[model samples]
Target: MTDDTPAGRSPSRRTLLKAGLGAAALPFASPAVHAAARDVKISMQRSSVLFTVLKVKGTLAERLAPLGFTPTWHLFTSVIEPMNAGAVDIHADVADAVPIFTQSARAPLTFFARERGSPAAEAIIVPADSPIRTVGDLKGRTVGVSRGSGSHYVLAAALKRAGLSFDDIRPAYLQAPEGAAAFEQGSLDAWSIWDPFLAFAEAKRPVRAIANGTGLTSYHRYYLVNDSFVAAHPKVVATVYQALVEAGQWVKANPEAAVALLTPVWGDLPPAVVAAANARRTYQVEPVERAQLGEQQAIADTFLEAKLIPRRIDATDVRIWTPPAVKG
Candidate 1:
């Protein structure tokens, strides 16, 4: 009301209430009801070509821009520690068994996307000149591997297939780089590792593959998200998945370009090394199928039989992100 309409009397309660509400709705509104939306934090493994491309091409951020998502990429060599500490919202191109092992520690992770395993990429490598010819020869010898990795299971499975177990070999649990150095220094008799490392070593040195994943393990890689992130943001999960799937297809069609894109990000490794690594991988991303997770169950059982995981996990019983239907 104007000052002329109210000399010494205050405005009506209804008028005051309306004015208050309008003022509150104005541009200078109170700080948001919740914290400002933060950029989606994604964890990328150094050797994950699809994620490397995503970061290099800067397309994921553009795809998510309309929704106000700033994609923040964090480079990591492994995800367990980051997942445990909740450092990233999502992790892509992780070994299928890695998440299962994380589950044993009770990390709430959801399976979101998958890339079929290529056994050729994950192998047990020994020096070409080494006399250890068969899996059985691995008995009582020093084998370097990173604990809780896909190769961890591979070492155990290969030994088991040869009528042995982890106990049969002296396990040297070391990261790929460290293991590479050790293996080069003649400290390790053999190294069980996955692609990029497997690919790099083979190309740069005189290493021979004792065995690959074919009969032993599928070596499937998966995209995982912290349970809380997917629960709070389903659409965000879909966006990430679609981006990865497309990127995977691009990598499959353009292996050389994939390597070129990944080289700089991967510390300028040789183009041939990157291409070989990409060649050894099946970059075809697909939806997570519950019925087809028998291998996952197998991985869980393998870990359990070897006392790697604390308990048997169904592997298929975790939260899975179903992509939203495409709009017409």
Candidate 2:
């Protein structure tokens, strides 16, 4: 199962937009192609601070224009679905735990870049006035979380640390927006969520962090491309990666500009909330380091133990995008 996609000349936009092949997903490992290109199909969740910056800056489009890569972005709350469906070529700002599930399913995904892990950015929150104070108190309570999300892993790990399991707690699976609403309406005892949402909840209501990713999960947001997509147009990955790095730097150095541009797009995410989300994340994007994949493996093993994924996964075994220069 190797993608022996030839690497000679750069592909045009027509070559890049061809989506990944589906169906073998995660039961076995195979080589993913990331060489040819037409237009780059990308997906970004709303809370992906760095990608949101990219969307706002339009830098990827500008950089890719000369290469004949038309950038198409879709908003999908979850990370793996679009890639799994072959509807997107690239998905950025995903969590460490997500690709593990995809790899478990043997899907065609390549983690091209990684951000420095920052553990405190995501947390399980309860109303500040609520009686539940710690992870132990969550037993038998209805908690909201997005299935297969970083927050989901955090919540599970937090429960295990407190001597509880998923069965001990009533888990309500909801996307980010719905979870926030459910939490606000007092429908959930606790909400496990990540930054932007975590920051939004904190700013909109009085909430207390019951547990964060610290000592539990690395919470490293990732940039992934469809296995075939990367094999088809590896340079597209490189170009986008470079743009993300610059945008991340610009975001940190100019908070006001970042917030002002994103506030409206983020459904009126307050300047403070947007700022907090950015502050918690490291925007420095670089090629994925093989040694650093242990955090992902931990998440996969945890999911396997909990049966969230059908089987075990060696997360480090999947495709990783190294820049062409590195490859040469």
- Tens digit per residue, CA lDDT, model 1, 1-328: 0001111223454543332211111111111222344578877654567876776677777777667676766655556777767778887577767877777777878888888878887889999999999889999999998888888878888888899998888999876667767777789999888877776677667888888787987888888898898998887889889998899899988877777776655545678877888887888888887887888888899989998877878877877776765322
Per-residue lDDT tens digits for candidate 2, residues 63-93, read 7877877676665545576556667788757
TM-score of each: 0.86, 0.86
Any residue pairs clashing in model 1, and if so which?
A: none
TM-score of 2: 0.86
User: Whole-model Cα lDDT per candidate?
Assistant: 0.73, 0.74
Stretches of candidate 2 off by over 4 Å are: 1-37, 325-328
lDDT of 1 at 109: 82
